[model samples]
Target: MNVYLGLGTNLGDKEQNLCRAVQKIEERIGKIVSLSAFYATAPWGFQSDNSFLNAAVCVETSLPPYEVLKETQQIERRMGRNYKSVGGQYKDRVIDIDLLLFGDIVMNEADLVLPHPLMTERRFVMEPLAEIAPDLVHPVLGQTMKELNA
Candidate 1:
């Protein structure tokens, strides 16, 4: 399976945090096929003095979607993230690894959502995603990443 992931950090050594997360993902998830350049952006949802360093990654993995989510969450926790954003309230963190897309699958389980629910709406995600997978289409939206990014 080909999966897309969005990585971000603002609470620590931002570049190192992203690099470490990418390394761990390769170790735990699968081989990374494509990776975008790091982008620095302001916080999205909530007020934060710390800006974010974000990037997107495409990976080839044999793990199922749920397993991918589990591993990503574990990666976040191991990297010093204490909790996930609740009720759409975001915060600055050491690392955030979001499972953006799992192949062309569309799922809305309580714990996971494929073609990530808010991916298209966030420039931080779409910009990097488009950079690496410009022609990749969103199964639900039926548009290419580059188009969506526009």
Candidate 2:
């Protein structure tokens, strides 16, 4: 399965955090097929003193969605992610790795959601994602990443 992931960091060696997280993902998860350039953006959904450096990557994995989520969380913890979002508001963090797509699968559960619910609303995610996957369709929205960004 081809999985798309969104990565971001706003604290503690931002570039290094992104790179390390990608390395960990490759080491523990599966092969990385494509990666997008890093993009700097203002923090979304909350106030923050530091802006974020965000990027996206496409990985080919055989693990199921839940297993992929588990591995991603483990990677985040390994990279010093210590706090979860409060009141659905974002905050500065060492690293944030979001699973954006899993081969056109759509899932919604208490702990995870495929085709991330808020991806279209955030330029940080859409921009990097569009760069690497402009024609990748959202399984639910029925639109390409480039169209969504437009």
Using lDDT, give the best candidate's number. 1
**Residue-wise C-alpha lDDT for candidate 1, range 97-119, written one tens digit per residue:** 99999898888888887878999
| TM-scores for every predicted model | 0.98, 0.97
TM-score of 2: 0.97
Model 2 shows how many backbone clashes? 0
Steric clash pairs (candidate 2): none
Judged by TM-score, which candidate is best? 1
Cα shift from native, residue 35, model 1 (Å): 0.6
Model 1: clashing residue pairs? Answer: none
Which segments of candidate 2 are over 4 A away from where they belong?
none
* Candidate 2 Cα lDDT to native: 0.92
Query: Least lDDT summed over 10 consecutive residues: which range in candidate 1?
Result: 106-115
What are the Cα lDDT values of the candidates?
Answer: 0.94, 0.92
True-structure lDDT of candidate 1:
0.94
TM-score of 1: 0.98
